[model samples]
Target: MSNIIEKNVDLLKKANVYFDGRVTSRNYTDKDGVVKSLGVMLPGEYTFNTKAPESMEILGGKVEVLILSGLDNNWETYGAGETFEVPGNSSFEIKVLELADYCCTYLS
Candidate 1:
């Protein structure tokens, strides 16, 4: 879970706001053409549905995640420098324990 600094990327001006603005993110295309988003999550629970496989990196805070499609079905906690992956066409539940800074990379 190294810190990711994306340079030479194309970013969208509009934000992706969800859960009544408790979560917000900006989508961007990195130099390598990978799609990603940088977002902040206030302490709240959120359910996200994904179209592509996603790698979620915890940048600064803590979160508990339960993958809807995973076999384990147990909630897992992640802190700074940790990451979790979710498969495409699946959904996940995330609980933010504190203000969380995160990066989500969409995988092909």
Candidate 2:
């Protein structure tokens, strides 16, 4: 996928701050009306609950993820250019090995 999204995007000016500012993201909607967020996470561990099915692309840095559902609950590592999916109405634990940049696309 391309790194740049050049047009027809509606971005919110305010950020969605979480974990006491350890994580921050800006919400945006694409031309196709897909809700997405571009965010950065500082080196730390965090748990996030999802309301919608999400596709998380790792833009930079390394992270270990453990999805908190289903029988196969193992920590998987992902780095830049990798992607993972989280089920709707579920949660996951993430350990950011370094400062990480990510983009989250909410699926319908």
Candidate 3:
């Protein structure tokens, strides 16, 4: 069984912009774990790294992303408040062109 844990992030800063939201909760087990988080962003470009053993599922928002993992590098674009899944063991980054709000849950 996995245990649920709550995390909070009122805001995340990148390049003079702020991403605001609370990281609601997360669940973890011996073999796997899941983390849920949310963020709202004003128009800008930002970049971040993804640690291993983590996957991200976008619950909402619109943005463009570039993923570079294991020999596969590509650009992915999302629409308003869309859901998308990103596999673990991949390194990626994101860029936003407009005001956007998103929630993401990570599974491993």
lDDT of each: 0.93, 0.94, 0.51
In candidate 1, which residue pairs clash?
A: none
| Model 3 TM-score, 2 decimals | 0.54
Displacement of the residue 43 alpha carbon in candidate 1, Å:
0.3
The candidate, 1 or 3, that scores higher on TM-score is: 1
Kindly report which residue stretches of model 2 are placed more than 4 angstroms away from their true locations once superposed.
Answer: none
lDDT (Cα, tens digit) per residue for candidate 3, span 1-108: 022333343333332233342223323222334344545655566655555344443434567878766566678887664555655655556776665656555554
Model 1: residues >4 Å from true position, as ranges? 1-4
- Give a tens-digit lDDT track for model 2, residues 14-53: 9999999999999999888999999999999999999999
Supply candidate 1's per-residue lDDT for 47.
Answer: 96
Name the best candidate (by lDDT): 2
Ranking by lDDT: 2, 1, 3
Candidate 2 backbone overlaps, count = 0
Off by over 4 Å in 3: 1-34, 52-61
Better candidate by lDDT, 1 or 3 = 1
TM-score of each: 0.94, 0.96, 0.54
